[model samples]
Target chain A: MFLAFVAATLVITYFSARKSSGASAYFAAGRRITGWQNGLAVAGDYMSAASFLGIAGMIAMNGYDGFMYSVGFLVAYLTVLYIVAEPLRNSGKYTMADMLAYRLSPKPVRAAASLSTLTVSVFYMIAQMVGAGVLVRQLIPGVSYEVAVVGVGLLMVVYVVFGGMLATTWVQIIKAILLMSGSIFLSVLVLREYHFDLGEFFTRLTAIESTAPDGTKVVRNFLTPGLIFKNPWDQISLGMALLFGTAGLPHILIRFYTVPDAKTARSSVVWAMAIIGLFYIMTTFFGFGAASLMGPDYVQANGGTNMAAPELARKLGGEVFFAFISAVAFATILAVVAGLTISASTSFAHDFFTNVIHHGKEHQPGQEVLVARIAAFVVGALAIVIAIILGPGVNVAFLVGLAFAVAASANLPVMLFSIFWKRFNTNGAVVGLLVGLTSSILLILISPDFMGENAIFPLKNPALLSIPIGFLAAIIGTLLSKEVPSEDKFVEFQVRANTGLGSEKATEH
Target chain B: MNDPQPSAADKPPIDWHRIQRDPDFSALVRSKARLVIPATVFFIVYYFALPIGVGWFPEFMEKKIWGDMNIAYFFALSQFLMAWVLAAIYVVAASGWDRSERTLLAKFGYTSKH
Candidate 1:
């Protein structure tokens, strides 16, 4: 089944690459995707293996605290819709750097933005590949972890290097449908097992009993928080990351430009919110149902919480259901890696190659696409190497958490200031990117994820500290910097970003 | 993707300052702000309320509503509804904003040549 999905996406890449021979087509799918299509693609791009496997596993292990992630992920869309989506779609050509450089000096601003984009995407890609290696190995007995990682890497490279955003978008749309159908099916199955009695389901889920070390009977309620988020401040920090992070995610932000206009961008967020929101709500049933049916002990024995959803599938319909859902999870990773590779490659070719290295010269029709294809292959190779070295046992959820922290801290502040503040100069944008990137990474390195238990940074997520530094660095740097944006630059940007006055027109073909 | 757009520079340069001051533009911006600002604030506060509730006051959040269905579950579920309802509302309100934008665009000669 997984091979079948891979074969289908490769076919899509073949056809998409033919027309995707130019910079515009390669980068933004010729800006021809409709709102609903882009919406599904965005859903596909944003919902990583973490959302599919990690969240269910967390619930199977931690309960209400895990549900907190779902809420944070969903509500974060409001920030995107209200503050950034239309503005980004109107102003940005291909990459996040374009949005930042609208008012700031282009070369330095694009360079900084590209650095941040690559960092975030690479971190995210590595974690996905590692998780994919482990998940694939679990499903199929013969494939070694190293081989699985390399296979995923090559497939993603082909999708982006050839098909670019067009193939990536279609792959994501298919992944979203498969994921939603699988989850909905599992949710129904879970409900049916309890005779569709919600109360009965909850009762069974929470009534999971065990014996303590002293042989005392212990009843564990899987319905509460605190089991995971023992620290109160950690919850707030995580909340901040999830709330502010999506607006800064490069792959997600670029999806806005894949549609034709600002109005389509705005509508796409709504469509995404609807699909993503429904999927997350269904996860509540899926996660809780997993706990009720399989119990945490069974899930933990089978290799922790990531196995919860799959284990529940096995119980519901034997081996066939498990294989189908496992295939869907693999497809989820493929779609995400393809999305990340495109975003990273687009940034490399568009911002770094064209702007910084080539001094803003127009590339011949296929030149930019060629550079982008090479970048995708390089990025995929780097991620695969990292995934192989790290091995399959690494906790990937933290890496994802770190990616969000960096995005919120580094990218969101610059993005918000660039689009909103008139006095936000080139100095601010560059400094914001550098400071946001460094502080979040440094903090994470010192935190428990990298260092052992006792750490320099108390919080697991650095966003609580790093987000403020990002904003303040931008604000102070702007106030202290010598270069001020010319009056014309601000006005032109406001007009373009706000009203879509001079937005890029999409090619219909 | 990298270079400043050629078509934008080639076309008649928009009087950005005039558009900035246009009443229709102001109305659109102001009205969208009116809805978006309050809605954004309400939802953020509302979203934080649940996490804070779960984090800070677990006993209260864990209070069972129906059998083992806790208050926390309901509150969390409500957020899904809140997002969908708010997003739906924003899209509907934006349609009116889109109409006004088109009307003003034609007035200001900002219509697309393509």
Candidate 2:
């Protein structure tokens, strides 16, 4: 089944490669993806292996605290649908930078935006790559971690370098479908185990028996909060990160560009919210199902938290079902990484290489696309090497959290200011990006994740502090700068953003 | 895929200042803001309330409202419903905005095309 999925995706790449020509086609899939298709792709890109394997594992282990992650993830999309998506669709050409550079000076804004984009993407991609390596090594016999990392890296490189956004979109769509099906089926099986009784399922979840690390057997209620997150401030900080972070994600932002217009973009967001909301709700079943059926101790004893879903599948439906769920997890990683690669490469090539270096002028017609393809290769290889060096011992959840922290802090504040605040200037954009990016990373380095008991910052996530700092920096930088806000440009931007007066259109065949 | 004709960059610049001041545009913006601003604030408040409630008042939230289902679990599930409901309302509201956009574009002597 894994081989079949690989073959199917490669076939998709072949077809997309034939059709994906020109910068628009390669970068934005010719702006032709429909509402539901783009919706599925968006969900696919957004729902990484972290959401699937990690969340289930977390819930199986910690219960209600794990479900908190699901709530935050889904709720964050409202920020996207209402504030970010349509304006970004209307104002930006290819990247998140395109929207920022609309009213401000192009070169500096693009440069800062590109740097932040790459930072977030690399942080995110490394986590996924390491996850892929660890998962593949565990699931398949004789597959070493290094080989798995490199293999996944090379496959993502091929997808972005050749087929570009179109193939990546399809891969994500297919993966989303598979993931949804697998979750639904698994949830049904879980319910069947309880005779499809909600009362029975909830009863089982109330008193879950597990053994502690110190060899003491403990009985805990899985339905209660405070199992994993002992710190209220830490939970609030993580909540803020997730609540604001989705709007700032470069990969998710770029998915809006796949649709023809702002209306389609809006519809696509609605579709995605519905799909994503449903999928997350199902996480309740599978997550608690693993806890109730297999027991947290059993899951921990077998292969640990990340193996909760797959182990549940094996127990419920035997080997065949286990293989199917495993393959879906593999597809989930590939789709997410492919989405990340294209967004990073697109920003680097379009924003940095072409606009920053070449002064927004490609010396050759297809030079930008060429540079992006090359960027994909470089980015993929870099991620592979980093993941190998970092090894599977590095905490995947921490890296993912840090990525959200940076996005919420750096990318989001600047993006919101650029669109809404007429006073927002080049100085604000650059300073905001720098301050937000550095503060989040700096805070994390000193936080409990790295510093253990002697940590300077008590919070696990820094968005609660860094996000305010980001917004303040942008405001202060703008007020301090003497750069005259161009009223004409702001007017133009407002007109275009509010009404799709001058938006990118779908490419006709 | 062919290039977009009269792409935003190359198209003849419209009288953007006039459009910004126009009643139709102002109405559209006002209408969207009406739904969006309050909805955004409402959802953000509602969303953060969960963690705050669960974090600060764990004993209260731990009280089972249903068959072994605590208030925390029920509230978390309600978030999914809240998000979907909000999204549906926004989509329905935005369709009106889309119509206003079209009418405004037509008055400006430009045919809006997807």
Total backbone collisions for each predicted model: 0, 0
DockQ metric for all predictions: 0.59, 0.55
Model 1, residue A317: distance off in Å is 1.2
Native-referenced TM-scores of chain A, all candidate models:
0.97, 0.98
> Can you write out model 2's per-residue Cα lDDT over A1-509, one digit (the tens) per residue?
98899899999999999988999999999999999999999999988877888788889987889889899999999999889999999888899998898888888888999999998999899989877887788688899989999999998898888899999999999999999999999999999998999999999888899998899999999998999889898889999999998899999999999999999999899889888999999888999999989899998876677778888999999999999998998899999999999999999999999889998777999999999999999988888998998887554655677799899999999999998898999999999999999999999989988799999999889999999999999999999999977899889889889898877888888
lDDT string for model 2 (B14-101, tens) is 8988889999899999999999999999999999999999999998999988888989998999999999999999989998988889
Give the residue spans of candidate 1 off by over 4 A: A210-218, B6-10, B112-114
DockQ of 2: 0.55
Deviating ranges (above 4 Å) for candidate 2 = A393-398, B1-11
- In CAPRI terms, model 2 is classed as medium
DockQ of 1: 0.59
The i-RMS of every model, in angstroms, reads 2.4, 3.8
